[model samples]
Target chain A: MGGSEHDDGRNGKTPSAVVGDVDDFWAQALVDVPRETYVLRLYVVGNSPRSRGAIRNVRKLCDEHLAGRFDLEVHDLNQEPWLARDAQIVAAPTLVRERPLPVQRIIGSLSDIERVLVGLGVSPNPAVDP
Target chain B: MDTYESKTPVGETITKSTNVLQKVPTGIKGFDEITVGGLPRGRTTLVCGSAGAGKTLFALEFLVRGATEHGEPGVFIAFEETAVELTQSVASLGFDLDGLVASKKLAIDYVHVERSEILETGDYDLNGLFVRLEYAIASVGAKRVVIDSLETLFSALGNEGILRSEFRRLFRWLKDRGVTAIITGERGDGTLTRHGIEEYVSDCVILLEQRVHERFATRYLRVVKYRGTMHGTNEYPFLIHAGGISVVPVTSLGLTHIASDERMSTGVPRLDAMLGGKGIFRGSSVLISGTPGTGKSSLAAHAVQSACRRGERCLYFAFEESQGQFVRNMRSIGVDLKPWLDQGRLQFHASRPTLFGLEMHLANIHRLVEAFDPSVVVIDPVTNFEMVATNAEVRAMLMRLVDFLKSRGITAVFTSLTAGSGALEETDVGISSLMDTWLLVQFLEGSGERNRGLYVLKSRGMSHSNQVREFHLGSHGIDLLDVYVGPAGVLTGSARQTQEAKERADAIARQQEMDRKQRDLARKRAQIEAQILALRAEFEAEEQEVMAILEQDKRRELVLGRDREQMARLRQADPNKQQNGGGAG
Candidate 1:
């Protein structure tokens, strides 16, 4: 997560570090909280527009519905081809929900929030949406 | 050659013809001959065999031959053996792998596919192998490629679908690069290749079998399928030795060998008389079969003597006896082979047939015949070949050998030892059909004696005698005496002698009776003549006496007649008178 900064430039959906201590506190809070936490990984081909759009859409969906209860990781397929091979990644901009039991995958920019939420097993609350 | 050059279609037709799956010669001895050229070029050939069938060695030798002899570079992608181990294993075969590698004519890449090292997190293909193979090929500019065993790769990949698709891609890649590739595979149960690659590499599929028959192991190679080419269908025996692998094609030369019309003597004059008095035709194969101790070897020795006496080179392969022993034995029978052997006209090569594999024996024979260039080659008792090979195998070997010799105009004689006296119809090797002349010798046991009888069973293009002659292995040599024809049948040995004696005795009795009849006729004629003379004399004397008597008797008769008349008259008169007087008194 500390290496999440876009040092190689040309980054659109750059990850924002919001309080390292708070993330640690959330990390501890994850054990105490009775809520289930989700682990997600997003694969992309560098910082392309489609990759950035997919990243933005996934992050917004997780923040709006499952904030502080989800862990996200991003991988540039070009930089880690072996990882892509290991995951059998045929297409880029793939979001794979790893944890919370039954794993799932969603391809393309992840624009449809409801479909992305359904694919990731995240039930959106109307109150949280408001 | 001129016709082929003139009949050539120009341009696009040439392209079309070349595109018709040209064969790439594998350069292995007898292999190219079997395939007529070799496997389909620019295509994959699957070589499947069980363990110890020399599958890896075959693939390696293909690459090696291609690299060294054909001037075509090769790359060997070994899946089971490392490059060093492979090199070491083939060192004894006189292949300098390191030197080939150094000169860039051959490249060996060991693709170590360990199942333990592979973790299938997801579905994967063997792209790593492809990259390595491609690199190896490019490194050597190889036109020939070998993948020694795809089974290990399959085990490592552990996905049949992915492996199959990857194999298809790999084969296509090899073809796209125009490489004649050999893919070695472990034999599956009832399948050509363990990975079932035969379906993919259907262009050519070769199957190798290592069979242990009668405690002797022999390796045989067969082309299961060859597309767009005519290949020998019979299984051919192959040998792996210090000179590398040699595939002995069943009859590689075929019937194309030109036959000679020349003739040579069989040494035994009477035996020669049996074979149309000219022995067998030069370059023709002759088979001699008989029971043990029936002078088959002696006949062969006689043939050797005849061949050598003609100042022609002779090769005598004696399986049962050593050269020294054979020479000594033949000398005792008046076949002094020692002089010919010393003069270099006769070469005696003696060895036990069990000393090596059947193919190796054939190879040795081929090598020796080529080196010696013998005009006559005599194999004493082809039955010895039966000890190492099957009947079919021996026949095949002899067929090839006969073809080779006949092509070179070499007279070949084979003596076979039958199990007993009964198998006159076929030799133990069952190669009677290959012989141009077949001489059957057997024991003619009669009158409590065993005599050797020789007869010509068949003579393919000659008028040979069919009579069974008495084959005598005397102190002077083989003597074929005329068999005795009598009431019982054709008699030989003492029976023949007895029959002859009886015939002579009957002829002498007939001559004496003829002489006695002539003497009796002479004596009877004399006696008849004397009796006739006496009769005549008696007639003459009687006549004389009659004449005399006639003269005298005529006189007397006349006198008597006269007397009679007188007497009669007197008596008649006197008596009458007396009677009358007495009557009156």
Candidate 2:
């Protein structure tokens, strides 16, 4: 896929997990058993520095752990504009998790790790990590 | 289906078969559930209450509910509150009065009545009110009319007699015209409406009150009298929230609570065990009655927090304490309702009883119950509510409410303040008969070291252990200890030896007792006085008749004298029966 994070997210325990954007599903990321699994397709326009950072950071974490726990497919919005249409991406960098229920999308640069983790398919940190 | 039903002639049904059909639904949440349908098709219902007891809201909501929910056009005629104020206040309640008014589905008329503003009897016959009402109603082709309140114009008129006649005329006119009207009135002491609006509007009269006792302000509603329909006579607790006025008429006492066979903790194992099977059934009414400072509220709060911890909705209606103080106080007991409130599962309806009357208290409770739909409800010290209702009647109300709630599957928790030192238990204006579980949080004063105790006095239809468990109010919350009951009941007083022995026990205790006694005495006195007044009225009528009789006797005597003079003239003419006694007879 286009340099996205994990592939075998269906089994969970992915390090570079992409959580959904909905606030209520935050705790779902930390659970041992996976309830909701999504086939996330991320859209980035022309591989900008922000896009490159997201791809590198996300892939690095997944390889160190999950490897095949989740599936992340990235598409360049400018190159395959038609793919963006399928995911209903209005902006350059968008995350569309298309499975489970209620197809969700998040339009942001995905800099905040907690946001990224919560937005993709990952659980929240159990403790505050004092 | 009652008194007037049999007596009054079956009036011609106004809804003709050919009339276009549409139902007007009053989306008062639970109220609609209670009414089965809504306010009678086209009959008027007088929603009377004291100032600021949410009379206007009740009427406006009826209008808004009719307009939006069921597509029934509505007209709101304001007498006291400005349109802007009504909109602003109701908007906080999540109701957009302006939008409804603008949609042309609703019409609002702000009627400003000034006594000085040239109101003459010859020209004015409530016609101004009628004109404005008609205009608004016509603009929307309204099926509902709410004059909130109708009495403002009457209040402005110094000539009270004229106001009474005008009220009769206005309501009659409305009835004839066929518009379901809700006329708001200011509640006086006795009558449903001030200025004796009760005599005329006997069909349906709903009384609302806002009482402030111990600095807590709450509202209640009661159907003082409903003519046609059979409704729960008990005053329903209501709440004025961000939505609108909500009335809770939980009048079904459970003779049929399914013993869940479920055991829940009282937060303290000992106390829980004492409450039989280690806990009370879900949706049961747990009453904690005790003298002041017996950790009643804390115990109730403990239950609430426990319920919340289990992720169930919990609501606490505190009559004595503020939300913060309640939270902080319960913090000692380790019970927190704040989290659930944040999650929209817990709600605290705190206000003073004196802020309204018994009806307002009932209405406030009703409103809160509807809005919260709490799995568990706690009224910390319903003694304030006792102040508003008659002991026997209050019990009846409670019984009905208990039954009502049990049917809906909700647990209720109440803390009753037992006044007086020798009080075996503070009898709540007769609400004991209605309680499902009675927990006595007594204060024992033996051995010079006063201590508090918690005991399960009684639990109806359920087995409970009869043991006194010790408890104390500390920084954390109410702590329950298994200190063997030394015979003396729960005690509360000084733990530390003081120097001067001053502070002669604050006015809180004495004042409440004094108030209770004073209220009793005053009620008795008023009853006696009313009886005496009635007798006096009868005697006055008789005396007036006697005086008239004496006057009649005097007039009779005068007539007799004239008769005697005519007889004398007849005798004078008897000379040959001179010209045939023409003057004799």
Candidate 3:
């Protein structure tokens, strides 16, 4: 896993670099190994403590396990409140895994990494499994 | 966030206003009147009901009516259905939800919670819902909010403790925002709501019930609790129709209507004569009770025609017959109602008695009376309601109807069909006490024939004739004739005619005998006068002979005196003696 590029993606500051690196990594990895990209969206209310905690925890979990194989988007419901109704977000700090065939939703701050990985259909022991 | 932290606590706010409770008018028909005003202002009212009990519609109507009628914008947060589905469902009720939303007067947020796709990881809060609600309310500046079936959240969410505390916070937040809100819940076993939502939103609670009695369903609304105001506690029957939910708060109607002294004719002149000289009083309820085929409807039709002829509008509700059939039947009695119908002065609303429950019928009558504003109304055969409702329910419904009509000063005529076995004075519906005037028509079974006899049983505030007139439904109209009361009691039908004919013949015979006696007395008087003339003639002749005899005696006496004078002169010696003797003779 490329740790620097994953850090840039988690910071959400260098989106172009993360995309370029992910493309390059995909081109090389496709020849050597087969991997599926994970699509995830995190719904939060403003910049509250819980919202920040959930965002940081989800980014750290994604970078440590599925570095170049995941795409995460943070949605602020305060800015776009109608999306909460659209996504059926009853609780704040809700994480939805939209891809991987069947959609799954988990509500809370994502403080437990094991539960987050299992909820997102990501293998905790990704190196040994793949 | 600091925004949620700075809100005032719910308990402190409620305690501050414990002396006076302000109400927000829902603008639902008859609902506000029952609640005395409406739900507590800036508070949440729990509406709980069973399945298919019109809970969503009730809440939606509250929001719609508030938005449209009270100029108050509303936010409808639906948990069970989407906005499009709700809008389409309420279209039949004449609610333009789409138009309202387009005009920015209403905002609908469909909060769909599916339990199967959700997995609870750890602690969570419902701040997302709060954000959505706040956004919707602010967008429309809504003063009224409806959360249709808040119990849906209990099914979707796993943790009860978090959901309960979050709901409490949400209710407090809504109150602090100064918006009146309604939260609907599915009824629970032995509880007001399945999830005990009532335990939080306790300012006001309304329970809606759809009871099936005798295979007919009736919706009732009861205000289970109102915090600080006096509200009607009875289960008021409500109807969901094209207009919307209308709660009939019948007991709230006060007897403060003014009585009118004006009189209107009953179309039948003789019937009018029977009911005071000028027919029934204006704004009075007249009951025409009779057995089947005894012309109860005909008598009511007469009043309707009479009202229409006076250029006053009339509404006739025929419970048993259709409009065409009723018109045709009335035409046979010479009471043509087609012209009145054509002219739009008389409106006919025909339906079966079993078409709806008693309250529905009453609500419909109220609606029609309001729309038509007719001066006269007729409910033909109110007894037909017995087939649909109990006698007490029918009576209560009729009492409300009568009170409504009386308050509006509309002359109402109700026909009641009495069973042949029951007393003629008693009606099956038992609504006669509410009537101002009662006309009883009975079948006079006599002389091997059945005759229709009509009598004024009671007419309040008027001097009416108590005579039971034998009325015939002729080609022209109803004709009231003097019933013959001979030695054989009250005679009617052919027996009356036969008695009348016999009296006429006896009168002729007695008149002829009187004429013969008069002629005989005249003949005897003439004979007595002739005999008197004969006696006067005989007396006159006899008197003349007597007078002639007396004259002869006088002349003889003169002759005798002259002879005596002559003889005395011849004797010459005693002239003086002879003169003396002649003088003596």
Candidate 4:
């Protein structure tokens, strides 16, 4: 996967909280790690822009890096309306890696390959040349 | 902190036969490893970390790994994430939280901390948390419990002091009900935990931090404090991965070195021949010093693999890679980590060196050694430890680790990073000072071919190769030469004398090998003696059983005699004794 999304960009994504030291799990995830294998499911409302974009971005990542290694299942809350209440998919485009172990759920774009991978059991890779 | 001191078993029948008091194992992999066996059956370990340090992941791992791996169900209490969100996040980590929920082995209770609502004027026990947690743990017969980001309560409550006291009571309550809990708190700089959770949880505190150095980010996990037991203080590097968080605490190697005479090979015949023709002494600590990219870790890994092939349990603590990554990379250099790991003969304890305090590393090493019972241990680079400890402290810690290894009769091999003209002897930060045999690796200046070299600076009670050998990593592994050192001083760190240095290394390795053999022989002798003692004990046990039986029989005979004599006297005293006796006859 291109490092674009994983790169802690110079935008509003820069944590609004002025923290000299990061304390959130996402910050720790930026130092992405190696892959273990993951099964993710994205909960979306419909073919809405936000849900569609999240799906597209995440699928690109899986195809690029995870490829055959993962099983990503998308659940459209709009289609199965009851799932929103049953599984309580409060946030749309919420992706979940449900297999291997230590299951993880990302509320937003499974977009950041690094965050998604780190959450999925793939550790951040060290530069080979180093 | 277990504080098991007060609750020692008092009165019980010694001869009883029962195994009903079995306890469940903690779900975290290395957590249990460092904890010797596992956490005490019914207690609490407060994992307080800064936000997003994987506190929730940790809690989930405890519950999921416990329920899945160790067969102990768990309850995960998330105050921020909704249960669905929590499930989704964990699903990305490869945890089937929903499936776990389905099977009833794991439960997720998202306690929405609505800051906008409510007044607690009365004595409101966090009975809600207790009820939910209790229900979750019991539904699947959970043996573990975790409250992710418990500090949220503090944030919502707006009373620090009350929260602190309440926490203490809550933990005590959990313990009484026999639940091994992991309560997570947010970290505030200079504070052990958010909302002053440390006041109540001085027992076991793990601090995880995300550090960005040179635009590169790393997560560190450190056991800041464990009240009763020793834990590594180093900030163990961790990765947020599909499996949640993988913590790598490099060899917390202590000064525990066991003196052994058994000859062990470095997979280099010449080198072995140089060490007195036997091999590196079994359980002997060897320090390999080198600059970056000098094949230090590769060479060490080769030696470790060699020992592992011989049925010795080898632990390779990589400060850089996860076990999976380490193996994958090593495979390119012809090192097969799978078989060893599969057989449980070789265990990898790979963590970033910066993740822990120097002492924490020592404790982690001790803990792993205890759990794995490895015969051979290897640390990739001891020099990195300088970043964590003072020089004196490093020396003392190494000495202690060496001593501990010695007591356990474990052979240790460590690589130390260096940047100098010669061997690591001149570099105080290197572990050469504490090593029995120092193998020097460096880049040969003139040749410019990334030359791999080796030499033995010293060997205690043994003669080893003095030559620096030219070797390279290949498909089979690193192969050493039987060559001599160059005329240029070994300190010069030049490649012009590569051929000569190779010879010297060979000779040194041979000498070290021979010396190692002698030590190994002695070790064998000692082991034999121990075995004899063990056998003797076994014999004594049988003897005691026989004796107990014989003594019991003798007592029984004496009682029979007393009864018989009394009966005779009674017979004689009876007036109709003679008539009765004659009739009976």
Strongest candidate by DockQ: 3
Q: Cα deviation of B233 in candidate 2 (Å)?
A: 4.8
CAPRI-style docking class of model 3 based on DockQ: medium
lDDT at B267, model 3:
89
What does each candidate score in C-alpha RMSD?
Answer: 15.2, 38.2, 5.4, 36.4
- Tens-place lDDT per residue, model 3, A4-109, is 3232123222223345488876566554332556667889888888888888888888778877777778888888887887787889889887765478888988
How many residue pairs collide in each prediction?
A: 10, 73, 0, 127
Tell me which residue pairs clash in candidate 3: none
Cα lDDT tens digits, model 4, B381-404, are 777776765566567667767767
Q: What is the Å distance of residue B252 in model 4 from its true position?
A: 6.7
Q: Assess candidate 3 and give its TM-score to the true structure.
A: 0.90
- Which candidate's TM-score is highest? 3
DockQ, in order, for the candidates? Answer: 0.02, 0.02, 0.56, 0.01
Tell me the tens digit of each residue's lDDT in model 3 across B131-199. Answer: 889889988999999998788989998999999999988888888888999999999999999989999
Kept native contacts, as fractions per model, are: 0.00, 0.00, 0.81, 0.00
Runs off by more than 4 Å, candidate 4: A1-130, B1-24, B33-37, B117-131, B157-169, B201-204, B210-260, B264-273, B282-424, B440-455, B465-585
| Candidate 4 overall lDDT versus native | 0.66
Off by over 4 Å in 3: A1-34, A46-49, A126-130, B15-19, B427-429, B516-530, B555-585
The interface root-mean-square deviations, each candidate in sequence, come to: 15.2, 32.7, 1.5, 18.0
lDDT of 1 by residue, A38-82 (tens): 767777765656667777877788788877667788886655645
**Tens-place lDDT digits, model 2, residues B1-585:** 111012322344444422532223578755654554556666678888877888888888888888888788888877677789888877887888888888898887776555433222111123334444555676789889887776665656555665666677677667666688888888877767776777777567778777664455556667676655655665556777656766655643337766555656666656776776668877677888888887788788778777877878877788899988887767655666677778877788788866766545665666567677888888777777766655654565566567766666788887788884765564653676667788887766655776787777788766787666667777666666655422343333442212113223545667789999999999999999999999999999999999999999999999997887677665785655535544445
Better of 1 and 3 by DockQ: 3
Choose the strongest candidate by lDDT. 3
